[model samples]
Target: MPTISMFYGILVSMYALDIDKHHLPHIHVRYNEFKTVIAIPDGEVLEGRLPIRQSKLIQAWVELHRDELMADWFLAASGQTPFKIDPLR
Candidate 1:
């Protein structure tokens, strides 16, 4: 997995394997021992679980970075830019 961004202590990453399967723009949130996949464009939860507090923080972060997130997703999928997302709001 390649980290796309970091926000509120959560590392946002995306995996090539994930793209091969899901084929959708998305990012993963990692905090402590928790990890959750967040679908881009719509900010939907795709997999795993996150604590309530962490989830709220990620939700806010995702909403604020929706545009950048999508851009990162495209760049990652297309192998244009290294998988690195912009900072959180």
Candidate 2:
């Protein structure tokens, strides 16, 4: 997994050649002990959990960077390194 961004205590990442399990364009997020997978197109939680405030922040970040995220998804699906995205600030 390659970390694409980090902010506040949250770390966002994606795995190269990953697609089948989740079956969607998504990113993995980790905040302390909480970890989750968030789908890109709709910002839905595909797995795990996060604190409510952190979850909302991640959703907002996804909405703000959907296009960039999708592009990164494509690169990752093809087993290429994804470009770093701007962290939420």
Candidate 3:
């Protein structure tokens, strides 16, 4: 997994050549002991869980960067390194 952004203790990452398991564009997020997978297109919780405040932040950030996230997903699915996206601010 490659971390593309971080903010407010949240680390956001995407895995290369990872499209079969979750079967959709998504991101892996970590905050201390909390971890979750969030869908890139709609910020849905694909797996695991996060604190409510952190979840809300992730959703807002996802909405702000959906296009870039999708692009990164395609690149990662092809086994290419994804470009880093700006952290939520």
Best by TM-score: 2
The C-alpha stretches of model 1 lying farther than 4 A from their native spots are none
Candidate 3 regions with alpha-carbon error over 4 angstroms: none
Clashing pairs in 3: none
- Candidate 2 segments exceeding 4 Å error: none
Which residue pairs show collisions in model 1?
Answer: 4-85
Candidate 3: Cα lDDT at 40 = 88
* Error in Å for residue 35 of model 1: 1.2
- Write down the lDDT of every candidate, Cα atoms only: 0.76, 0.96, 0.94
57 in model 3: Cα distance from truth in Å?
A: 0.5
Worst 10 residues of 2 by lDDT: 17-26
Writing each residue's lDDT as its tens digit, candidate 1 over 10-84 gives: 887776535776667877788999988888777788889899988887788778878877766766777665446
True-vs-predicted CA distance for residue 20, candidate 2, Å: 1.7
lDDT of 3 by residue, 1-89 (tens): 89999999999999999888999899999999999999887788999999999999999999999999999999999999999999999
lDDT of 3 at 10: 98
After aligning candidate 2 to the native by TM-score, how far in Å is the CA of 3 from where it should be? 0.3
